[model samples]
Target: DSNNDLNDSEQEMVDIEYMGNNNDTDSLGEYDDTEVNVAGNESDDNDKLSETFDSLDEEQLLFDNGDNDTDDDEFMDDWTTDVIQSDCEIVCEQNMILVVLKKCRGLISMIKRSTILTLYFDAQRKRFKKALNLCYDVKSRWNSTYCMVNSFIVLREIIENLFSNKHQLHITQQQVKKLTNFELTSADWHVLLVLFSILKPFYLVTTAMSGRQYPSIGLAYYLLARLRNFLQQHNKKESLLEKRLKQLLLKKFLNYFDDENEQMELIMLHAYFDPAGFAALTEIERRSVEQTIKKSVADQASHSSISVANTLSITTTTANSENKPNANRNVKRNAMNLFNEFVGDIQYGENRENESKRAAIINEFYQYRKYVIEFNEKHEPDAGSVIVFWRTYGETFSILKGIAKKMLSTPATSVPSESCFSTSSALARKERARLSGEHPCSSVFLKDKIKL
Candidate 1:
């Protein structure tokens, strides 16, 4: 919510009259007497913050507030985001949010605490006519940090003016007292740009896997592989500080991918059936998954062949087919074939018949393997899901399809279940607090369900 105080544009660059004015600094003197209007933080003060700002003219604030940078020693008269991004692409690109937060935090707090600052920026947004506000980091989400750092790079001019030397002169001495030591340096700005570039891939991966509208598992392994490659490729080119951060990040990533060994698989067994994910597998990994499906199919066939009906069917079908069609031809089966049929346990078979059934199952997997290999070679990267792929091809390889039905339905992440819990939590949080336990329980339980 504190994130709403953001504006980006140069279109109409209007003037906003300083609050109660002759001087912009004139309003800073009276801010303590007014309620703070920053991102939901309220103050019990003489008047509402908006009423004070709403009365001002926009065109005057643009020049009266610290926005005028013609004589500012730290920044150019006309610095743009293009130059900032070029610097962002080159500097020590670790997470710069922490640095900027540490360095300018006091000044930032000072700015946010002043309703006068909001009044000036709000008037600016109206003049420029832009929809998106600058991004402020939300601690609970990883991507929000990227958004915050990017906001810094994109809105450097605004930020520079807010902490510029003249900015301190224009504000009350009490507010500017501690902010003198926290101004942003050019190097700090570069770090911000570079950090934003580094976080781009992470932001993309988080967004790609965050789909609630679709099964995102199909892209799971594919995105992971690409993200891994990005870090490793950039690790070599990064500055010392960045290289260390990349290594630490890479290590943490591997922990997520290869975390469990004995019970759960990190490669996502479901991924092998996903067309996008299948393409990410190495030849060895492809064989490993293929072999696993083949084994399942073979095991299923082995058990089925041992059943009474299947044995009888196999015996009548494969044993000297010439004998089945009596009019066509009658040829006696070889003595070896006859002896092999009854060998070991006659009921359970332990015979060539059951082995042949399993062999047929394995043969089915081989055919599936061939089709899949060729399929991936020609597969478009962005289209199709595992469910659709198996659904379309399952009929041709019925045995393999059975295994795929169970394997491919596996969720790539816990987002689906988390979504359910999140809703319950939201419901409980809204009205159940400080109520009877059973009352809350019934309310939570029936939040979305019909009583009937």
Candidate 2:
């Protein structure tokens, strides 16, 4: 009864000018205080209340459903929640929501999520449920949290039923009262839908990068670029909650793809080498990457040639120093001339070889690009390994193959290495275990390398 009265009062306040003007208050107070509350003036008060309600109807007509203010005001009313007017306040509120989400991923809270999952999965087994199972989230994984939230959205009807049929669950009246907010309204669901849309791309990238068998680093640049583009595009169109989420995600994305970082070069090189990734990149990006690799290859070659020449000169000087000075001066001079001629020939041959290789590499790059583009245009995108593609064509493009080998060697993530260590730790978990250190190391190696 008290709750009903509270609702009625709140409804009435919606039409009331509770935010009274100071200037009007003095004019209104000029009237006798006793006259305002008299029985004779009761009709006047009722008329004023009716006029306020009439004005509210007019104001409500001005608010389109599409407007942010109208939607958020209705959303707040539905949830019995407060409106956050300032962008800063909204952002702070979103941050608090994120913190709450993290808390919800803790042990006890996860048990509740797991309960919902069990209910869904069991009901499906019983042929009574048509929805997917709710996923449990780990505190360390944002992807897992996204999955859980997504699952909740997908199976919202079933979850809503759980709270509705609280009697069946034997929930106490006090418990129901305390957990009332957990019953998500349509407005809450809409907010969650927005959140899911924003996080789905990030979830995809996380899944892609977590691969064990394939090269993930190659897709890193593409994925980051896609996410940045997605956030930028949606930042303006999104609601306050979604805008806050995009801002947070964009900041993180920019940090990961920072231009000054050494890893950026490594990622770009890997992406260039990956056939699928190369196809994904724009023409400009592909050209830039190719130029960078070519320059790097040339610098390496120059350095190796200089080192070889230095070593040869050092050997020649040592030999010349060991021989008698005057006795074999003429012989030494002749030997020096012959050595100089040999060195000149070697340098000339190397220069020619290097020039030919550089030309071949440049030509091969264009051919590869053209072939890949035409092939993609003619065919649907495949999810097969880029390493496999390069290996298949290794002989055809020898110089490109070399670059592929170098780039493909770079790991997309350190997960595999971390996993190996985790496996080793698991092997040593038994107290007073008699296993040798080498045995655990060997087991981890064979587990990863062994093909079934």
Candidate 2 ranges beyond 4 A from true positions: 1-127, 130-136, 167-169, 234-248, 314-354, 378-385, 417-452
Q: All candidates' lDDT scores?
A: 0.56, 0.56
Model 1 gets an lDDT of: 0.56
> What is the per-residue lDDT of model 2 for residues 323-403, given as tens digits with 9 covering 90 to 100?
757666655456878787776645775697679768987988887877666655754533345655665666778677777
lDDT of 1 at 332: 71
Q: Once superposed on the true structure, which residue ranges of model 1 sit more than 4 Å away at CA?
A: 1-97, 103-109, 127-130, 134-140, 165-170, 235-241, 262-266, 298-354, 417-452
Worst 10 residues of 2 by lDDT: 11-20
Following a full C-alpha superposition, what root-mean-square deviation does model 1 have from the true structure? 14.9
Q: Which 10-residue window in model 1 sums to the lowest lDDT?
A: 11-20
Listed per model in order, the count of residue pairs whose N, CA or C atoms clash below 3 Å is 12, 1
